[model samples]
Target: MSTDNSEHMRTIDRWLAGEVVNNTIGIKVVGGPFDGRTKIVLLGEDGRPPAVIRASGGPAGPSRHAYEAVRSTDVRAGWIYTYTGPEPATES
Candidate 1:
């Protein structure tokens, strides 16, 4: 598959336009379907990355998977996360 991260870049652009500042961080996924994939996420006001990150394989219904932040030695490039599993069912 193509390794284009333009979508992630667009997210960062949007954040910049909104004056979000320098809270963007890189997240590396480990274990699961999206293993080895990297994503860009915005850090919270407290300078802490998100606890969980969600993504989909295509333009489908709900997200295909979720990743939980396990640890991070460096917020810029060492944020390590693991795939939790498929998205939980939601009430209709």
Candidate 2:
């Protein structure tokens, strides 16, 4: 799995299927209505990108200029959506 933490990586015995993990670039989208949408996860207080993405050209937000510019290139940058699911029950 893609993790954003600097902690030493280690193998574990077991884990819950839906257990929240580190946040990072989970998925990359290319085409369709939602283009350049990357899944940046947020597991508790963990996870953060090393640097911000700088677009060589085009305006910010959903714009034809940005979309076309990104579509023309082999690949570019766009938006990032944080991933979150129903929080597991916590002990009170």
Candidate 3:
């Protein structure tokens, strides 16, 4: 991997490790802006969790996921600014 990519992963790792997104519930990961990359962004309801996660391979990067809790008088923006991966899976 290149230096830029390395730095990107490192930074993302640190953020993931920190108090950004929570793992309380299973997350939904999707592809990212960059190729071979995936990311998850959270816009907490009522102004709570607003975090971003982006990862790539290099030792192979990790998958990303985010979830938002619902609250009255608030609308989550996570869906608005998230990566649109390939089509969803469906049962035949």
Candidate 4:
């Protein structure tokens, strides 16, 4: 099986083993303004991430940036999110 598939299976195995898997998942962003950034995002009850994510602008201001999930891939360490662009009016 592919490495990606293996990683997914491991996650399932952990759940089956009664391990308290964390709802937060690591994600590497690709493309868009926040490209090449990595962050930890919350996952839904169904073990899926939100279609869109908002990141804090930190230091620059209290504004937040939005990134739409274009694609995702499972890896041993975490998942990857390919973002397209920041959503309009997402900043504050």
Candidate 5:
């Protein structure tokens, strides 16, 4: 379990560091079934990191809403996806 956490942390670290790009990365639910609770993910460009974006209220349609809203202003400040799954168990 620690290994899984560590791997996820590393991936997030890379993503936060801007090492990843959008549209090239793909996400997968590795630990459990895609129950809509633990299957949300963020994809990035090839050879880059990926980030998972979440909102304050809850899950909503138009996954790209947040991405588009943020990207419209800055264009390169955050992840390119809106999360709609269970909260991450561990954060680094």
Candidate 6:
């Protein structure tokens, strides 16, 4: 498989594993913005509240916009689709 595919699989795995902890529970970046290149991050320990897990096109790039967007959305009622892949997912 391609690296992108691998990363995507990893993302899914992380999500299912509950390794990701974010205030934006329902808010998921549909297709990882930077393709499979997008990074997955987790904050806090097992039960603590998760902070920001920012993904970007370029490594070391800022995630202010993503943070704002996620915060703006209703994590309980709405979700945010990030444009980070070669092509965005159709079924998000």
Best model per TM-score: 1
Stretches off by above 4 angstroms in model 4 are 1-21, 56-65, 89-92
lDDT of each: 0.68, 0.30, 0.38, 0.60, 0.36, 0.40
TM-score of each: 0.60, 0.19, 0.26, 0.51, 0.28, 0.24
**Candidate 5: tens digits of C-alpha lDDT, residues 1-92:** 79999988776655444344333322322221231222224443443234343333333432221222112122233333333444544544
Better of 3 and 4 by lDDT: 4
TM-score of 6: 0.24
| Cα error, candidate 1, residue 64 (Å) | 1.5
Question: What TM-score quantifies how close candidate 2 is to the native fold?
Answer: 0.19
Candidate 1 residue lDDT tens string, 38-88: 666788887666889888774344457888987666433546778788887
Worst 10 residues of 1 by lDDT: 12-21
Candidate 3 per-residue lDDT, tens place, 2-27, comes to: 99999877766744433243432123
Better of 1 and 6 by lDDT: 1
Candidate with top lDDT is: 1
The predicted structure with the larger TM-score, 2 or 3, is 3
Better of 4 and 6 by lDDT: 4
TM-score of 1: 0.60
Tens-digit per-residue lDDT, 1-92, candidate 2: 55733232421111112122443333333343344454333333433332223222223333222112121233222223222222334466
Error of 5 at 43 (Å): 5.2
When sorted by lDDT, best at the front, the candidate numbers are 1, 4, 6, 3, 5, 2
Candidate 4 residues 1-92, lDDT tens each?
99999998887666433233577655667665567666556677866667777776644354566766544334443445665444456333
Residue lDDT tens for model 6, 1-92: 99999987776665544344352123344434333332333333543233344444455353322432233243332324455323232453
Model 5 segments more than 4 A misplaced: 21-92
Candidate 3 global lDDT? 0.38
